[model samples]
Target: MKLKLLILLLISGYSFSQVKKPDSLQLFFDSAKFSITDAHKTQLQSFFKDIKLDEVLQIRIKGYTDFIGNHVYNNKLSKKRAKATYIFVTNNYQFKAIAQQGLGELDEEIAEATIEGGNSKHRKVDLILSYEKPKEVSVSLTRKQRYLLQLPKLSIGEKLRIQHTNFHISTPNITNASKEDLEGIIKILKAYPKLKVLIEGHVCCGDKEEYESKIINPDNLALSTERAKNIYNTLIKKGIKANRLSYKGYGFTRPLDFPENTIAIQRENRRIELKVLRK
Candidate 1:
């Protein structure tokens, strides 16, 4: 009866503590055990869910054991313990973690040994919440930023077209004017690292053949494909993983409006579209 009350108190206390800013916390384990109790694990997972950890940031996890085994064996056991928690987090949460470590056994002289139920106190893991500090630049989201934050909720088939009139002209060159827009995109990708997108390039239909013919390439696809590739290159240069992004071109093949429409509409048709492949 007393044990049940203690667990109830623990769960309630942790629930209250979550209202504050995230600080480092420890999750204790049983002797020779890597798995946390269902109650404790549920509490830990709830804490992570309550927080808004970006998909890009890597989580730090460390495991330690009691001074009951040899150093070599304890190290290996401690690592397994850490890995168990690591797998649990990755499988359940959106965040990616890298700093998984096993500190072997805790020194008995330095810390209190968990004497109640085998050395349970020292046999435990710690989760240190950490984040990558964004570059100190004053960046405010405009009304247009709704596209980035709310995009994941939209239909998967919807293609998000990016407009950079000053950057991607009828040609493939990307200029300084396009950098600001591209920077915003990079920030979005970083915030949601798990997202994958396909960059599609489309060109205005011209009187002769097609706008894709503007650039001659033996492969028969130019202008449009190059434009898409240019945006892909730009994102890669900005440190976004290449696997998360891809580029393709469809010269005047997919038109939103009539091909022979007003210059404004024509320009709209010729655009770089981000087809969100996965969230």
Candidate 2:
């Protein structure tokens, strides 16, 4: 029965991958003013009203100036503008990370033709938002795989063991056979976009002190945590939304068997489990 289930998962993982374009927004500044004006603040607020900061993987801010002043002055002005925008956003919203840069004056060719007033278009800060791409498409699934996709049916706090997912001995590296099981999980996540899960990592052994000398990291909990994190990162790379997923390591604290004297029992204890966080 386990072999059949493993085969089904392996086949289910063969889906598709995709790419998505980054989102962009712009804030125009006055000729020499770097401070964000009231109108600009309003625009920024409106632009970010619908965006979820947690879902944003990266935020890039590029500040530019018109070709009116000396290179040094223009460069400083651009940096100030970028800094002002960065401060406003960081103070208002909570995101993973942000990158800011000052490009100084725009090239003559690229800079908007100086009109009667000034190069208003060229004096601006550009904002780009990046998110993880969704990497699944419509695909046939085995009966068991279909069952796995029914995450909505499960109640919160319920745990589902990834049967075939296993890690190397005392290491975070997952075996080749376990990669299929992870892909199968990814497919299920893609199928039910609303479903959220907490990945829990477990290991087999005696007390922490007993395994401290045997393990490379010297920390049993860290090893288990790394194992869980490995799966978490794989899910992210496979296009799973980071906001919908989280992971933690339990070490050998939550073992299925007490005396793991046999290799089979130990293998059973060293496993990955997913707890339903949202359905």
Candidate 3:
């Protein structure tokens, strides 16, 4: 019992000793549009001087926007702001800062188009310095595992998904779909009730010669549409709202697993993809 207590005390002490103070910085924008200024640069230099930038540290810079524009646009603007700050740090300070990121418009201290107590704090950049290395913080996932579980983000409005937008919709023969795959899709819809999905279907051709022309073949549309319509009907029969669902068949135009030009590749091309339009 005494040995166990001693070990616990030593572990706790080591953990406590690793903790270091992080530096905080705030940059404000007063113009209609945001821009990085000389004052911001000077403040950053002063802050870094107090802390040791020579020591290994990770710099996290986040940009925030007001609620004025669309969320997607605001998110992009925030990234730009963050990148600008990172460039300034690297150029002026001549230090290799790792992992610069933008948080976009997610965090806002002030309301857009509204001033409280004669203060508006929406357009700004937040800089943080951490002594922790990134390797200790990143989580790893294998390629096969990540691909099997990919899904688009469902937003209440348009452009809902943030990742994998290129894979909007796809369809393959439902007859060939495994029971497990069907159940997995049904599970996704049931778990997220507000989700509106658009299903697309595709068909595989044995020969790469099929796609020789700029124009698409009519059979491609027929096969793709058939699979998509079937899936849409199934979901409706299962009690999902008809208004919340739509389907389109691209035939062989959109392949999920394989590139065209061979038989095996064509088989992969024939698949189904579900896109979330609303949540």
Indicate which candidate wins on lDDT.
Answer: 2
Q: Can you write out model 2's per-residue Cα lDDT over 1-279, one digit (the tens) per residue?
A: 999999887776643223334378889887799998999899999888878788898887888888675544676888899999999999999889888877666644334343234577879898888786444446456544554554554445446778878777889999997766776788788878888999988888756444323232347689889999999999999999999999988666556554567998888878888878776
**Which sections of candidate 1 miss by over 4 Å?**
1-140, 143-146, 165-169, 207-220
Q: TM-score for model 1?
A: 0.44
Task: Show the colliding residue pairs in model 2.
Answer: none
The better candidate by TM-score, 2 or 3, is 2
- 2 against 3, candidate with superior lDDT: 2
Give per-residue CA lDDT, model 1, range 140-170, as digits (tens).
5555453555444323333566765333455
Best by TM-score: 2
Model 2: residues >4 Å from true position, as ranges? 1-139, 142-147, 208-218
**Lowest-lDDT window of 10 residues in candidate 1?**
211-220
Candidate numbers sorted by lDDT from highest down: 2, 1, 3
| lDDT, each prediction | 0.68, 0.75, 0.57
lDDT of 3: 0.57
The TM-scores, one per candidate, come to 0.44, 0.46, 0.42
